[model samples]
Target: MNNPIPPRAKKIPHTLEIHNHVRIDDYFWLNDRENPEVIDYLNQENAYYKAMTAHTESFQKDLFAEMKSRIKEDDSSVPYFYNGYYYITRFEAGKDYPIYARKKGSLEAAEELLFDCNEMAKGHSYFQMSGLSVSEDNQWISFGIDTVSRRQYVIQIKNLVTGEILPYKIENTTAGGTWSADGMYLFYCRKDDKTLRADTIYRHEIGTDPSQDVKVYYEKDDTFDVSVYKSKSKKYIMITSESTLTSEYQYVLASEPTAPFTVFQKRTRELEYSVSHYGNHFYIVTNKDGATNFKLMKTEEGKTEKEYWVDVLPHREEVLLEGIDIFKDFLVVSERSEGLNKIRIMRWDGSVDYYLPFTSETYMAYTTTNLDFDTTILRYAYQSLTTPASVIDFDMITQERIVLKEQEVLGGKFDKNNYIEERIWATARDGVQVPISLVYHKNCKKDGTNPLLQYAYGSYGVNIEPYFSTTRLSLLDRGFIYAIAHIRGGEDLGRKWYEDGKMLKKMNTFTDFIDCSRFLIEEKYTSPVHLYAEGGSAGGLLMGAVINMNPELYYGVIAQVPFVDVVTTMLDDTIPLTTGEYDEWGNPNEKEYYDYMLAYSPYDNVKAQNYPNLYISTGLHDSQVQYWEPAKWLAKLRDLKTDTNFLFLDTNMDAGHGGASGRFEALKEVAKEFAFLFDLEKIKS
Candidate 1:
């Protein structure tokens, strides 16, 4: 952790390949182990806030409290029965605890549920895998819990009428389960991951035989993706995943768990599917023409009933649709326009359209909907630069909107009101347009000299949109500009966009990010020397690419639990997330594939160059990406790089890819990141 980063003019050394067993004892993994002087410096920072001056935890508590009040009086909602209560972990006394709140009829009784995570974990430790559902008649309640390993689970069905609980313990991975229409069939998908390659879908006749002796017709295979959807008494299972891209379809009839599954018929390589059933028909949306726009097709008895189009915009990139929400005859469709970055809702017959304005001012959004026959409640929550996120609830029928919550900053200290969301397009060396979303305080002198932190993740068909964040408010409020570089390897532009950024075209994602950084400098948003970049996991690759390609252009780099040794990880089958990702990253076993991967693989491409301030982090218990990749790479950088901005290794001993065990812990990590950036850049004020 003491080695200084090497300058771009110095020669870079090749990383040594070693059979290092990655586990808990690595030196980089530790908590609260900062330099004594640094600890003293941090304690002095407590004059403002205790947890850390980098994060305003006090402000956050006040914000959540205010948000709770806002959730009240926001009456617009969807018709279907939904559990209005959600439980979250709270830190009280000396232990982590669980709290819940229930939304009673027309009144949200937001009271803390008297439950503790420690107590819950004592009996049912796998609360993360727990499931909750109340029967349609509100007479029966069913819930399931998992035991860490052994793929074991216990399903408990309680009779509210008699207050009797019948629990069954089974050892198998339950992909999903639902109650049948007549409440007779308890349909669930169970797979023996220890012995079998593919999981089978099953129908258990509750109160009859245990889960082992269940019925599975035409047993589902492992090659395709299968998902079970539940809506009241309706039970529908969709199985896709046959082709490289799986499109979902509705399952009408039950299949035998003992037999093999039938091959899907109407599947095309160019198309993907998602299904929903209502009114004796299954609504199907297909992207056969392109990954952007979709054609809506409704089918009956596994046959097409009528085919039509929704959100029919110009190209695939312009029109992005979710599904056909059917309510009696009227249908609701949601559309996401890529170019404009706005969400719009329309009817099944393509009539009565309304746009749910996209909040371009935030970092990202987590959207959810609660609906029924007549009413629909849409909830969108996000975070931005100046403004901490506040949820907004929209009533579809009356079109009435309510601000569910806003962070009530203590003493009115933080306000992002003057923040602006500017969409700037940067052209890659190849002339491809890479969009960068920026959120920064308005009155912050535009001398193009402020510190700019550009973050990006260009892999795994994931999309990073603009959403609100209260924790990040600490940074933006501190005279920093927050931005997200929407490059490649994300669904922001659909499947083709992802396809172009992965495998052989992997370099495109890196170049696109580089272009974004360069464009920011050209636009006078910030000076090239003050520019900072970051990426994690897939995005971590982006960080490495930018740092190595033009280290001098950036002031610092934060690569968290990165996959730098791509060629090695892709070849080793023992690592998780590799075999399945072969489609995304080429096979290193093949000579051609190995050569292609090595071209951009950080380790292989390392050479003498001026580098930026680098901070590398990893977790020991990462089940997805191996921690060894970064551990070994950092060791090489120590022996190779030839300059002076500290090269730190902050590896977590007991964490995973998420980097923390609790919610606040994650915020602590964010604080450390901000501290590192602020320290390296020597930011004023």
Candidate 2:
């Protein structure tokens, strides 16, 4: 058998390779609990992971440290950690930069201090403390800090109007900011340590004492989080639970926080309303009628439980309804028909609202907000063949649109006109139609010689749409097409698309993605020899399985932060994301589930086979997908395979899933992925 791995990585995404890295070893966790190697690896990293958790326990010390550094008096260059106008100043060597807040008014250049990456990295796994999420109003900033143990950190806040730095108040070790309608009540839920699993929701007065004026919601025995939202009249408060895939929600009196009552409720299911809001009345769409279909309904009497469901948009056998929002009297939703997503707007009165004619073949909203009762501002990104990623603002009432601050908040020399986007359809093995979004240079010839790259994550009912990226432009300029395989494992074509690509139907996702690559070849969109595939986490599993099953189809493959060890990990409930994944990937404890998962568990099925130019990157700090899985799989490959496929590991000792702490750091990580792809150069046919 003459199997060989090609030089795809070096030629495509443009990154130099580190070769012949290690002498193969026996599987690291093969000995299970008695493994000495496991102890060595654990002792080394566990010490670091525990640092953040331990420091958080002593709350005062960590808070005191940040207060001293960023919250000190006379530090005007830092952001004013205020409620509305909150932003931070980064005084760099050659430039003075400002990190924008969600709203404007809270802090000034002097009042807020910038977070020190090095200082904050202490006591955390790189994977754990890697994200920063600001509240909708932009009054408070919440970030994950210290990974030794996972605890969401409460950063400083500034009064939007005054430059006064509010006293640092602890929300919860695990609880996050659940800002109120007025932004005064920052509610959060804490897992009662005694129970360890179940948590209790608590409302914090933000700037007040940690003890007084605290309101507690349901004290359940399951792990949970709170999502706070206000109705159009500001009379209702919606609090959704943080649970596994199917979490139930409870609505309470917003003005009467202490009121012991739930207004209306809907438990999360395959097709039920995951979330809802008010226009003049309650509007919701759920897969409740059937997993493959959605029944849209409106409500006026919320407290009364009634089956007053209306069918605004019936189930399209192919179109997937991604999400919906109530701006004013209108309801806006983004739908994925075939594989292209377009934003559609409708009215509560059952009349056609102004529909923003599907302009960008690839359109979707990231998040939305209401400016007033009649007008709303939708913040999202829009792109097509002629567009790069730019944040846009749409007036829901006036139907006016504006481009917000363009990206490159960090500054870069990016050419916008070099690349364009397009939609293409691929036929699946089961005669299903799949759509892929492609981005390449306008001047590039379609002679099957251009390097082509494809990315897909068909899991967890998420819809992968198009967005702008400068890191990817390097490949387009070099005659490469960047694509997103809108395959199964997502609601790309509605519930049926997801149902067909999940659990026992998971192989459909892999084959659909493969079929997409084949369609590209059949249509001469690109050459198979130049084709490359990549994905992280669940998508990484898809990439791993396809390459192993059909190595000849691809020239190169990159699986970063991959979840390839399916059977072993999913069955062990201890892994961070496993239990919640059972709804998506069937629980392997039962014989049926065990067989289904074993059917696709890539790590366990590694035979003496040739692989695509392979690059697997894992982070020791990855609390989600443990580093040991990929490390062990590569070891098996080293021992079993005689092919020239390359393996590379750049474990971030500090990052969580996404890797990197700041925006610049995050870009660097993304740049690394692009570098690997650029070097591989999807060899044109």
Predicted candidate 2 versus true structure: per-residue lDDT over 489-578, tens digit per residue? 887777777778888888898889889989887777678778889898888889878977787888888888888878767766665656
lDDT of each: 0.58, 0.60
- What would the per-residue lDDT of candidate 1 be over residues 501-572, giving only the tens digit for each residue? 888898889888888888888877887767888888878877877777777788888898788878766766
TM-score of 1: 0.76
For model 2, where is the 10-residue window of minimal lDDT?
7-16
Question: Residue 370 lDDT in model 2?
Answer: 38
